[model samples]
Target chain A: MAEHTILVVEDDSTVRELLKYRLGKHYEVYTATNGKEALDQIEETIPDLIISDIMMPKMDGFALQSALQADKNTRVIPFIFLTARADEEARQQGERKGVDDYITKPFDMETLLSRVERLLERIDMFQNQLDAEIGRDFSNRLLPDHTPDIDGYELDFHSESRQQGGGDLFDWTETEKGTYFLTIGDVMGKGLRAKFYAFSFLSYVRGTLHTLLEESTSPAALMGELNDMLLNDDVLEDTFATFLLFHWDPHAHTVTYANAGHCRPVLMTPDGATVHEHSDLILGLEEDITFSEVSLDLDPGTALLSYTDGLTEQHTQEGGMLGEDGVRDLAVDAYDDASSIQALLDGVLSQSASDSFEDDLLVVWLKRLAE
Target chain B: MSFDAETASSETVIIHVGEALDFRNADDFKATFQEHVDEGVRQFILNFSDTEVLDSTGLGSIFSLYRAISPDDGKVAFADVSEPVQVVVQLTRTYKVFRQFPSVEAAREAFAE
Candidate 1:
């Protein structure tokens, strides 16, 4: 156990000496004459907690707390305000500024010490929980490199997680000659469990693709097999995922796709943009589910975009959804401008009402080349 | 996390879920539902018209409630499931486990039947 460090800010020398003497027995105490001095002390060495008198000269305690709250580096340090005036307004102001604790003047030394101990314990517990979450999230996060080079086709993919670990996963792999497999999916929840499920699903798909490509490359067959495999995993009973799988053949100039309750993929042609809607339920729901396949001829300069529900379900400023139609419109505009897939996806995100996303976002776009 | 439970009939209790049922409020949701079950309320009508979102944990909590009442032959149905909540329920196949109705009145009538 490390000796906790505490900074005591007080203008009166007598009170400062008393605090230092009492707190020093349990913690390493640092002294500051006023708020200004305390700021300088914090810059030098950030203490575990700060104890300051409210009515000090050369920058009052409120100003000091406000400044500390404004600073990202020192904002999270546990703060305790010592106030001579025990008025409701002062307490309310302290509460509004997010002070950790408050001690009225003429208070017992024992009371102050116990409060400090309790606050430090709470801070330690919170820090442990946060560190564990970050560790789990970091360990589970997966970011694949750029798509592999394929002849006569341009592919672009983008994905963002709302948290440290998100539920969205997308991958593109060339299975054989002129044939590629692309998939995008979203697990039911967020955080560590979602990430684990996503990684497991991705690996299962990849493994199955390798084995099944030798037998059959039919999208419908692949989806059906994958559904059976997922249904066998009883641990995933409470969770589910929406997935879109595409099989592209550059030599044949066609793309066969299967949907599993994911958002409809948008097809952008010279004429306009159209959504490829299918009547498929989400994956992992049942063992005997069947997924139908749809094949489309890849015309020169045609773009197909697949994404998770996070994109269409984005909220607008007025609380309305961007919806599938909005995404289609964006795709149509992007196709008209002939923008890069990355630029088009960026445009879609920029139109989001809030800067913070509530769910993971994934977008994959592929355009056939004119030969 | 607010739960409003109303005695719809002699054996049915309609629990109106408040906004946002997710990981943060899952425990409270389960606890509130369990409290009603403990008081001999067998039939449950979960009204989700006010619920804006429900994640996997929220679904897990509902499943837990279902499991708790299953052995006793207690009934659990959903009413007025919002779009967001319906998406989770449908995707997880939870809708198959619990019957769904358009309104609380409909759910209560199902319990009566």
Candidate 2:
């Protein structure tokens, strides 16, 4: 932790000096009598981290934390709150305010030191990842690590996050009943916060899916339960989301799907492509709303093009967008010759304004190989 | 890309919407309308003639606006909606909540009395 700077704000002269002395040995420790002093000191020399006391003479630690959060430059700095041990109120407030960590008032010196070191190290690690490996790290944490290898279908998927974070996510599981379920979901909103919410939403779906599938008879039935779950979640209740779910029955050789306010998917046959124009209201919008199911028997050489709005909403060079028709035409043209979603996307993006889309893109191509 | 509004009467405000209203611009769109709602403007007429698409997030924002003003007997309507936007509205069944008109003038007149 050499060369790392830390700001310690406490009104207690004894404890403040002690922390300065102990932490000074390993870091450049700055002292402040209160939150006001801390702000003044920070304006001169921004610290790499902050350890603050909630009780102060003037301008409490919570106020200090809010000030830092309001400033974009200091918001990323890791903050540790010093709270009275066993004070549930302080702990809950700290959690609500998104404090990095907590050091109870009676904390051991060694524990505080170790936590400081760990927090700084973690800050550095995430900084490195954010600078260079955001997309890679995002996928590693959120997306399915590997695509499933179903027996009869050759499935291909392409996913990319615009600006390193997106609301798009997908997961597939092979059930014990010998059926495969693949779903591509887009949570409402965008950017990093939405990215995290997408993870939580997907996590809940993945966790409850197996049991829900056992009880629910069809895709639409399962969708109702999913709707109930969304409405029940306090955080996700107001956020609208679109989900496209596809269930493949190997024995029946058919794919049944249910759409919840998602874009209509396109079916690429040997002759041409047709848009499956069916949908329901987006989730998190209404209660008691139901989704409808559509099933199609897949022949030997049929492929389904399912994607988020990122594909169709991409800006064309003409300053106009590539709307649904353009996307359908491009998918049809590409599926005629290319066999991979990557190739199909490459063709679609070739005419787009840039190779990188402004939104998260997820494309799931389920193709039945011609025997 | 942009959100603009003009008062048609003491109660109705017609907003000119442009391009796409997905996640990218949904917040801005809502924020603009929120300012009007805060200023006591209730009834809203959205001009969707130029909008190409409305994503879930964008639709959610509109729903939020609907919730914000509906308690005051305020209403929201779409005028000259493009086919694409119409499809999304119909698909979501939001058409039941908000009526559509052929032009901005028609929407404004419907709210007159």
Candidate 3:
């Protein structure tokens, strides 16, 4: 285990020496005479905890706490205030400023030590919880690390959620017959609840796709079944998802796709770009709704891109959205520039007004290679 | 989110919602709407003219309010829905669940029937 470091700030030499002597056995101790000295020490090496005195020259404990809180780097470190004034007002002020603990002067040594130990343990517990939440988020929204190699085609896929765990999901898999099934979905909303709904939707689709595949080859039929399943599932009544499913047949060099109120997919050819705009009602809204499918022959060197609303709905500097036209223009420009998939996505993201999106974004790009 | 409720008539109430509605304020929205429902208001006009966005959770809250009032034969309607909100309403087919009108006066007239 690494040694825990503690910084003690006090103006009184006697008290400072006493604390250093007592804490030195268990922890590596550093001392500062005032807030300014303490900040300099913090800059040198951040300690696990800080014990500060309230009344000192140059800078007081309150000033130090404010300075620490203002800085992102030192704000999370546990802080304990030491004071001579035992009045309720002083203690309340410390509490209001988010001090971890307060120890009055002439206090019991054991009491101070125990409080320090408890604060450290609590910080550890909080950190553990945060780490676990991040782990769960990453696993639930896991993206494909590498695109599956398919004959006669080059594929690229990218997705980014506005939050750590987001509502956007995408996946592609090849069945035993070598048919590729690709799906992308966006659950309506943000945060953990949306992520939960997205995960549930993905799991249901993955489990039922094979059976639906055996029953029908039409994308519309598969979408209808999926819609019914979502409506029948009691948990999904209030929530809805916009989804798109695509089936690519390598032998026939054809692509058929169905949209459930998702954004239209853009097809880029040597001539120009066209958006496939056929769509049905979003899922989980009504029962027995039929989705429509659009099929197109995959001509050599033609590329297709599908994405969620996040990309097109992003606000630009002028407070206007980069709508479908902007997305198409960017895609065409990237294609003309002979850019890689990553570069194309970068071009799309650069149009956003901010670094992060208000909604989750996803894109799937596929191009048929020349024979 | 901010909600303002006023009695438009003895049987109808207008609830004006301000700003965006999503998971952040869904529970508050539900509670505020239910309070008026318990006060014996049978008809509700949700004013969304000031509402910029409504996510699924916000829509769910509206659905919950509908479920609450439907048992009593009460009705729910929307007035002055912005263009963006209309797209969501159309895409989710939520328009089927609630009646929409051009303005508060039109919705109040519809409630009289």
Candidate 4:
């Protein structure tokens, strides 16, 4: 609460001086003889509040308020009127003009101060709420940060909502047993609710993955256990998350992953593409559902693509499918310039607008680097 | 927010608000009660037992009324504020601004004191 700017408009020299004297104690006060000068000062520095005399030389407060209302920029500014009439008509007229509050002539200092203080406080609270909404939006656009990089192992990520906020996430961590754990998942929906569920799912997986490291290093078994946990949990039952569990041998140049009803992970090479197709059922589908794993041998510069259904489900403006071909073409073109998994994944996603993503999408790409 | 005012005395006004106190419905509330404020009716009983929900803007509306009556050495008291409305009023720190009573008679009695 530094000195708040208050613009005061009054024609009478004595009354104007009194307003300046009293208001200066609590605010950086600006004085204007009439409406014309007041409007000019308003444009120069939009004050926190305005107090104007209803009857002034040349232009009156009502006319000034009308001018302020006519312009969209100044319409919402808080205003209070000072009037000597103290009649019913004058009160009604001020109320009709959307005056925040009014004081009669010969008003006490305390009366005027109380009205001004209350009005200023309300405006401050409203501004704070607007700022919170923006911060929440920004965080939403950069969520679940995980994607395999060009190094074949490190995580990388880029969000369409980086400015506003985006959801899809991928991450990799090594266990105490010296085995690596990799997971990729997408939460349902978008905006604040989607962002909330995405973080919840990520936290559950973090602990679940650590538990799996103690028992087995197999990707398929991890998927089975993860699905069962999700199905049995009450809060998570309503949330549908698609995930892939992976174990890699960096020295042997091999990767094994179990897919849980997620989109097939594509292997992108300069020569062509190879999709690590899904042969298993979706997790949390049923108690008896089984998951499967696919193994791939990597060549240097070969990029693996894993993503949410949002990529393939992108549609054209005329409602035709950007389809599998549009997505494939994007991957093929990107393979030339996108050296890393993060780069390739972002390239394909950037081709389609965020609003066009069919569902919450998360993609992880990893490429074997040159020796 | 609309009010039904009955002059309890030359100096006091009983303003009964019988609907939702909100931005969408505040006109009648203001019009009915503000007329009394303008007449310098120093004491008031703002009966909100009938209001369903009071949003932030609605609280500001009441704040205006409080500011109006308090300056003239008059006080505004709440008569029979509903439980849920009272919860919102308390949560928004507005309950501290108004005097509350369980019944209209209690509020009127307090206003007289």
Best by TM-score: 2
lDDT of each: 0.80, 0.82, 0.80, 0.68
Worst 10 residues of 1 chain A by lDDT: A135-144
On lDDT, the stronger of 1 and 3 is 3
Q: Tens-digit lDDT track for model 1 on A1-371?
A: 45799999999899999999999999999999999999999999999999999999989999999999999999999999998989998999999999999889998999999999999999889876885576456434444677867777788777767553357888777876768888877766656667777777787788888899899888888889888877676665545677788998887889998887777899888888899876376676545767899998889988898877677668867676677888898888777454555566666667777775656777788888666
Interface RMSD in angstroms for candidate 3: 3.3
Per-prediction TM-score: 0.65, 0.68, 0.67, 0.45
Q: Which lDDT value does model 2 have at A42?
A: 94
Model 1 C-alpha RMSD vs. true structure (Å) is: 12.3
The number of the candidate with the highest lDDT is 2
lDDT tens digits, residues A177-275, model 3?
777888887877656667777787888888888777777777788889888887678776566778888888877878899888777789988788888
Could you give candidate 1's per-residue lDDT for residues B1-113 as a string of tens digits? 55778888878888888788776777678778888889888888989998887765566567667756776887789899899888656544456567899998888777887
Candidate closer to the true structure by DockQ (higher is better), 2 or 4: 2
User: What is the DockQ (computed on Cα atoms) for candidate 1?
Assistant: 0.24
Write the residue-wise lDDT of candidate 2 on A191-256 in tens digits: 665676788888888887888777664878777778888877888756667888888886688989
Q: Over the full model, what C-alpha lDDT does candidate 2 score relative to the true structure? A: 0.82
Candidate 1 Cα errors over 4 Å, as ranges = A1-141, A234-237, A337-339, A356-358, B5-13, B30-44, B54-78, B81-100
Q: What are the candidates' C-alpha RMSDs?
A: 12.3, 11.2, 12.7, 20.1
Give the better candidate number (1 or 2) by TM-score: 2
